[model samples]
Target: MNVFQSLVSSWQFWAVLSALAAALTAVFAKLGVKGVPPDVATFVRTIVILVFVSSLLFVSGQFSIVRSLSRRSVGFLVLSGLATGASWICYFRALDLGKAGQVASIDKMSVVLVAIIAFLFLNERLSMLATLGVLLISAGAILVAVAD
Candidate 1:
C-alpha cells in the first residue's frame, strides 16, 4: 500500500486526529462557555454530538447494529456515556474558571489514569518504556497545570 493508504488504515492516524480535535474542543469550549452556565454549555455540546454521531451512524448504515448489541455491551456503553457526561460537565466548569491550556493539561491527565486503570483492571501489560512514558505524561500534565 501507498503511504496514504497505510495511514488511512492505521489506528495511530485516528488517534492523532482525535487528539487534534480534542485540542480544538478545549479552545472552542473555553471561548464558547463565556456567559453561559457550564452545565448548559455541556448540554448543548451533548445535543450536537448526539445529532452528529446519529447522522454518521445512519449514513454509514451502522444504526441497525445498535439492536444487535449484547446486553453487556449496552450496559457498559451506558455507564461510559454517564461517565463521559460527568467528565464533560467538570471539564467545562474548569475551563470556565481557568486558562484553556491549564484546563486541557489537567484533562489530558486521563491518559495516565487510563494506563494505570487498564493495567489494574483490564489485564493490560505495559513495557518499561511505556510505563516511563505514562509517568512522564503525568509529570508534564502536573507541570502545565501548575505553571499558570
Candidate 2:
C-alpha cells in the first residue's frame, strides 16, 4: 500500500496529524499576531476554520447530522465552541509573549486537567497505569514550563 493508504489504515494517524497541525498553528499564529491583537487574530482564525470545516461538512454530506442534534446536544456544542474560542484567544496571547515551546508545554497541562475533570465530573475511571500517566504528564508539563 502507498503511504496515503497506510495512513488511512492507522487509527493513530489522525492524532499524529493533529499534533503536527497544532504545532504549525502555534508557529503561524505567533507570526500572524506579531502586530495584531491576539483576540482579533483568533477571530480571523476562527472565521477561516468555520468556513473550512463548513465546506468539509457540506462536501461530505455531514451537514445532515445537524438537524438530528437535540437541544441538549446543540447547547453543549455551543458551550464547547465558546470554550474553544476562549482557549484560542488565550493560547494566541500566550504565544505572543512567550516561546512557542514553553507556551505549548504549559497549554498541554490541559490534558492532566481533563483527566482529573473526567474522573470527577464524568465519573470516568482510570486504571492505575493511566493515573500514573496523568501524574507523569502533569509533572512533565510543570518541569517544561519552569525550565530555564
lDDT of each: 0.96, 0.90
lDDT of 1 at 142: 93
Give candidate 1 regions above 4 Å deviation: none
> Which predicted model would earn the best lDDT?
1
| Number of clashing pairs per prediction, in order | 0, 0
Over 1-148, each residue of candidate 1 has an lDDT whose tens digit, in order, gives: 9999999999999999999999999999999999999999999999999999999999999999999999999999999999999999999999999999999999999999899899899989999999999999999999999995
- Candidate 1 local Cα displacement, residue 86, angstroms: 0.5
User: Per-candidate TM vs. native?
Assistant: 0.97, 0.89
Positional deviation of residue 100's Cα in model 1 after best superposition, in angstroms:
0.7
Which 10 residues in a row give candidate 2 its minimum summed lDDT? 22-31
